[model samples]
Target: MTDRYVQATMDVLGAARDVFSGHDTWRPLEEAIDAQLPDDYKALIDAYGPVQVNGHLYLEHPANPFYPLRTWISETIEDFRDVDWGEEDSPQFGGKAGLIPIASTDRGEYAFLAPGNDGGQSRIFSCGRDEPDLYEHRMTFAEWLYRYLAGEEMFSPGHRDFYPGPVRLESLPTAAGDRSSKWYGQERST
Candidate 1:
């Protein structure tokens, strides 16, 4: 059901809050985490196994002028069984990229939409990671677009990465990048 994805994302948030709400200085269990099912998210669990939510791949602690804290939920490609997540011979990401992610942290909610110009291509946006007022203003972008496409299971940053696609190097722009100043990453090369 459409609501299922929301529930799964919520479950993860609950766990995060439990661990983070208490202190001003708190980090996740690890940079690279293999999502452990919270029982409630059992249905959300992928057939392959639990999803790869927050990871070092998304969050780079490097000391750069651009922001770094890029936390997000990464899902395997097969999660989208029928969807053409990524095509073969994609130059950038190379091969099939199955792990799609809904990126979020203290930065904001953004989705690595899908691979376009080869595996290295993607469309990122603030999903629900906007400020209180902003979140209210946006977030329905992906929802509306996916609906127009008539996609059965739309990809939410926090939902299961069911789409089988590629994770190209060029697409890894930090939230601070021109893509939108929604989060902190790197400045887009004009």
Candidate 2:
């Protein structure tokens, strides 16, 4: 079953990549499948039966919603505590987080996301019968990489979640020869 699903996933993704790129606002379920499904994704298929992402059924979107196989979230950004957390319905929090289903022509629909506890960082869980309420669990940076996408530093600053500043160099190498030194002319000419 897993092998068949993975094979079907690949076929759908190939076509989704083409159509999804153009429709930025309304995307095909194939996009996520193409992006995340692994070559041997069958090995990772969920053993606990089917699951949902956000409130949508695993494959409920207009396009087919592929079972995530497994979903993960990581904390790549910093300063989330700095953001002014607010109502979930607010523009900042509402649309910012949810189950984002990716399209797949063959296997079906797929999703990727970082759902917030109160429009903020907390645990990530797959949507199911009880949805986030039942499936939710703590997700930390050490465990997942996808959490990085949740915070948009440049676009939404008030949202506390910010990317780390560019790394800086701390030290320099010694001059090989006095003649080659940047200070060479300063002392000699003086």
Candidate 3:
């Protein structure tokens, strides 16, 4: 169940084959947030670390020491506390069963992992720039991420197609701070 979409994404992106392959690294964050993140999401992050997709979308890394995930999630949740979600009953954040931020874009788009309304499965909830209503995607993190990478309009409303060139994953240096290169990346092979 966890490997399907993640594998599809890895195949498309040509990411490193060696994934982190363990949940021990996420236990602290899981305990802090009191929620379990999807296995595919964890696997993807473990493989790719923090990366900027095509120079816009920034996927946060839980293991980034520079910007601790706990602080980042706390700040993200706080930033949305006073927002007008445009829904009669808005979803809460940072609680035992609340939504958690996973990524964001320069254009003010936010992607969150939310507890499934139907069951305990986790799903993606997105908020577009200047868009008050949250768009729910009843899919796992890897499913949503794979769609986004493939140019599906999973988050935004407009019909912006896929990138002109190969999908470029610009690795953020913070995750691997000791590396000599300030920035490095891999492009999806043709």
Candidate 4:
């Protein structure tokens, strides 16, 4: 099922028609990661594939030729694995269900997911590239996206503000073969 937040955002902003940029199967990824990701996150990727939201925020796909989800997660985890976040609630990187990056902005701000206790939903955390701390948001992925679309200051400072008016989604290549294909070459500008 499509996530309500993604569906509503698409309903207002429009989506790529007749294109499936998401994964064909998720079991392998779940198994590899040793955790079951949030349904809303899976739905978001399935609904939009790899895309640049409003030309800055990037939502990467597992099969993305430029930057696959696993590589992105690994790089992020490695980069911050040793940083002492100072807060007792700070989630460490690398584990069965640790801090996983969901989205990133061109400005180097990342939206991370901290696993919830007892099989509950993961909460969203925002971290700026230059900052030493993670900002917590006690909400689901869907809720964070909803608030982000509503332009409620969800991301770290210096990232672009949510685009004014309607959301603009630019499709990205999901596979190596699509890189040179004209169908996936163009970017939609606001």
Candidate 5:
């Protein structure tokens, strides 16, 4: 099942190889989160590395120094705590516990995963800066990705400004001489 999701995503994005560092590189991030990340996310990173989908969605990678997943998750959680979004009932915006951000958009929208509910399954929460309400989807990361790529209205109906044409995946440049990083300059294909 996990392989199918990874294959489907790669097929849709035209990804050619497993450009990212494997499970060893992801250890620190998983430890920080205190929970194992979804298998679908691991497969996505393993296959595509750090990528921007259609120049709109940015998925954090283990080797991204500027916006590593650990930093992004911690910072976003802190930011949610600092700002008063006026929704006390909301866990993500109101500083309620058990939610972590997974992906962020160029448009200031974010996708979060909330665990410890519904028998340990994670639920996805999509929210934008301008909107007070959040869009919730009770699916795994792979299911969500499949629906998102299929243009399902339920994922993000109002914000449909994504590049509707063929999807493009651009590999971000890594630091020079960083051989330990998966995005090392020499390893990148032109």
Candidate 6:
């Protein structure tokens, strides 16, 4: 079932056949986070690398130093902590301790995983801008991805809608010195 879902997601996203990093690349991140990333996420990254879905959602990839999972998680947590959750209009960032940001939207909304809950399998929590705003989905990352790609409104329910279309797969831009770029004249003149 999970394999089917992963394949479906890849098919829908029009991802390339070769973008995966080896398991060795993922080991350090798992060790740092002290949790095994969802198989679905690993598979998705393996097929698509890091990508922006529909020009809105951003998923972290381990290979991209700029937006690696570890860095994004830590920075997001710190930023969330700095926000005042006391205000009625403020978003509840730290309401659920150990909630890790997995995906974020362009509108400052995020999808989190409550690893401390449900015996560590993780539950999906999303904070959106609307009444009955914060909600949890008792589904695995794979299932949630399937529903999301299917435009089922699984996260925000009636408040959000997604139209299924040609999903775009974009490579995360690396830093100037990170690699030799032919376009930037970083390649050695031979």
Best lDDT among the predictions, by candidate number: 3
List model 5 lDDT by residue over 151-190, tens digit each. 6643355655434545666665555554332221111122
TM-scores of all candidate predictions against the true structure = 0.20, 0.20, 0.82, 0.77, 0.77, 0.73
- State the C-alpha lDDT per candidate: 0.27, 0.24, 0.72, 0.68, 0.64, 0.62
- Report how far residue 43 has shifted in candidate 1, in Å: 22
Candidate 2 residue-wise lDDT, 121-166, digit = tens: 4343222221122123344221221222223221122321322332
Please give, for residues 98-180, the per-residue lDDT of candidate 6 as tens digits.
Answer: 56677877777777776655764547887765333557887777667767766676557675545544554445554545542
Q: How far is 125's C-alpha from truth in model 4 (Å)?
A: 1.0
Say which candidate scores most in TM-score.
3
Q: Which ten residues in a row have the lowest lDDT in candidate 6?
A: 181-190
What lDDT score goes with residue 173 in model 5?
52
TM-score quality measure for candidate 3: 0.82
Q: How much lDDT does candidate 2 score?
A: 0.24
Instruction: Look at candidate 5 and give me any clashing residue pairs.
Output: none
Model 3: per-residue Cα lDDT over 1-190, one tens digit each: 4458878887766645232344355888888888777788877787776667777787766767666666778899999887876777788987666788888888888888886455855579888876877788888889898888778887767834377546676666564444422233335543
lDDT of 4 by residue, 1-190 (tens): 5456756655554544434544455566666665566888877776666777766778777766566777777787887777787888866775665877788888778888776564554578898756776788777787788677766767765443755556767777765556422222222243
Tens-digit per-residue lDDT, 133-179, candidate 1: 11111222234223312322223434333222221111233335434
Root-mean-square deviation (CA) per prediction: 19.0, 21.4, 3.4, 4.4, 5.8, 8.4
Give the per-residue Cα lDDT of candidate 6 at 22: 55
User: Pairing residues by index, what is the TM-score of model 2?
Assistant: 0.20
CA shift at 37, candidate 4, in angstroms?
A: 1.1
